[model samples]
Target: MSNLYERSLNVIPPVAARATKLGVVKGEGSYLITEDGKKVLDFASGVAVCNIGHNNKAVVEAATKQIQQLIHGGHNVVYYETYVKLAEKLVELTGGDTMVYFSNSGAEANEGAIKLAKYVSKRQGIISFKGSFHGRTLGTTSITASNSAYRKNYEGLLPSVYFAEYANCFRCPYKQKKESCSMECVEQFDDIFKRIIDPYSVAAIIMEPIQGEGGYIVPPKEFMKAIREICDKYGIYLIFDEVQTGFGRTGKMFAHENFDVKPDIMTCAKAIASGFPLSAVIGKKEIMKNWPAGAHGGTFGGNPVSCAASLATIEQLENGAIENGVESGAYLKKRLFELKEKYPIIGDVRGIGLMLAMEFVGENNVPNGRAVKNIINYSVEHGLILLNCGTYKNVLRFIAPTTVSKSEIDEALGIIEEAIVKEC
Candidate 1:
């Protein structure tokens, strides 16, 4: 029989391409058991979905129990224990003043979030950052500006959408340095509202707390606060696309907590349900309540098994997983900084908690995507899996499981360093 990758070539389209071709039969903790029987250290974490680690015992048990009880009860038709319970848990976690709407994927949740904003606010304009990736749906594609390729040939997207520069201090869009920064990222809205679209016309402003596909760019606390203020001033809803930064990936339950700022709306997925397909559009009660019965609906939005998995996943995160992520993230970041000092190719290292990244650059700080490509290939060949991000694909992100141990991080770091030494 042909291997999985070989068999896939005839059936799967290139659009479903993956970072690696290694087909795995099973996963345990931080490692994947490949069909060829090699144990590959998984730092990709299924692109931050298997956050609590692959096949976590509690998650497995919860999902198994739920499956035995119920498989699918359409959210639009009926209520279930796991689904309602998970929403209550999320409400409690998010300050008891918010409500959640379930969906199947990050893109779906984002689509719902924007719809909620537009429905409640009765506005048509939406503002998104230039380097943000909301989702792939046509509705979300209108608000996503991370790459032109995502929008290629799919023009005439949702209109009344505007763009703003994200706060990337490293490569400031306005060319301002950290020391001399005038918060142009925030002030740009003035021009946007004046030149692009009226603030009053904007229903929502969607952004990733930490730009995922664009690069692991973390905006400053002041920037977040200012954005909140802007939304408050204009009576426009603020939406955080936390698909890649929610759960325990950012040390905190959500990345917004790091800035001490709250958004009117938030979208979550990826790590929400261990490896289960689950996503949520979490909005303040005031806003969510305004979005009545028929505003949004989905058949498999709140899968009983998925909700059970999410609850177990949240329980794991609450117990000690987040703390481990904090400690391990700090260690990994410090080690990465050391690597940066030792290698000129490492132009920058940034990100919070386990969502860290290293941007490779060549002569005069030019993006070195080739170097990143080579390093990822070399690392995989040597029994480690990694992923790349950024519009230029020069940024290598580390999405290690929050439950990762010091020894596991050390091992991954060793592999990374070896790859750097060999490829860079």
Candidate 2:
């Protein structure tokens, strides 16, 4: 038998997972075909990047046409139609009058947003929540305090960030009785701001409208409205990091829309280009005022190819993709809820739209890590690629394509049910 996995040398810094066998050969709609000719149902959607689904003809054709015409341009010095179109679409969807800065990834977009917040406010501190996963880059890493494993080795410079517990709702951070809790998390932030970070010193308060990697934690509409009021009262810029929740992952185009609140600045990347690497920091015009000609620039910031793909993706979303996302996401969540009722291991199955997750907790409501891991591993082996996240690594996050079919969801759920039953 020919070994699909073979050699390893030195040059490449290996990832913690399986090494020497970590290549993906090709991707079709909702599946990836590996080099060894294995078809893997991609539920993770490349970490929630492929919103429109894989091999989408519109995205591919747009990218191909751009590549055939122009490959590179100093984007800062040029006024390309594709880039301008993208900015226009973003503004229209956000329902905010703002400027935009293009970047290579969500982290870069967030970094730009951070700089803009400080530049506009001249404030030093940034307030972020615990159990948040921003990105691996230095600036974003500073705001993120998710896992110690990701934070252990890297030392040098994370500073001036304050943390307040967000509305976990399911798992109360204060250990307060669930019945008596009245969004005390928001009240806790009042104390955090007064004692730890002076409102004047806080440039921005950044958070995911719906916590993505912290196990799809969805807060109540009132919580968001309350925060908006706090930011308004304090003149602190509210930065919504919609890197995972934007572009129809949530039932609304932007999760913040679900609430009657809006952010002063928003950063997005995943699902922005429908599998292409493109991110943007969009903010109110006043906040974006200090942007000099060259303050932020990347070699591939808005490469025509990616921009074209993004424009096409955005157009499709505006037309009907997002509408379908709402319907399909509702269906997926409902089906998962049905499964949860049948299975006691599913502690909480909650989400909005296609952004969904199941937190596994025992009968006593403590996190069940082994059961969650078994379900994930078994589902992957059974043709459905499952993902895990949470402070305890016990939440099963489902981020398949927004275009995922009901039939596919049914099949995946069946496999998950069997796995949980067998494992438990």
Per-residue lDDT of candidate 1, residues 299-392 (tens digit)? 8898999999999999999999999999999999999999999999999999999999999999888989998999899899888999999989
After superposition, candidate 2 runs with Cα above 4 Å error: 1-11, 16-23, 177-179
Q: Roughly what TM-score does model 2 have, to 2 decimal places? A: 0.95
lDDT of 2: 0.83
**Compared with the true structure, what per-residue lDDT tens digits does model 2 show for residues 1-424?**
1143443424434553541143467888788787778887788888888887887888999999988888777586778878888888887777758878888899998898888888778888899988887888888888887777666667664678888788888888888765687778889877886678778889999999988878789887878898898899999999999999888888777788888788999999988888888999989887787776666667789777888998888877777878888888888889888888988888999998888999998879888988888888788677788788887889999888877788888888889889988866
Per-model TM values vs. the true structure: 0.99, 0.95
Error in Å for residue 200 of model 2: 0.8
**What is the alpha-carbon RMSD of candidate 1 to the true structure?**
1.1
lDDT of each: 0.93, 0.83
**Candidate 2 local Cα displacement, residue 277, angstroms:** 1.2
Error of 2 at 66 (Å): 0.4
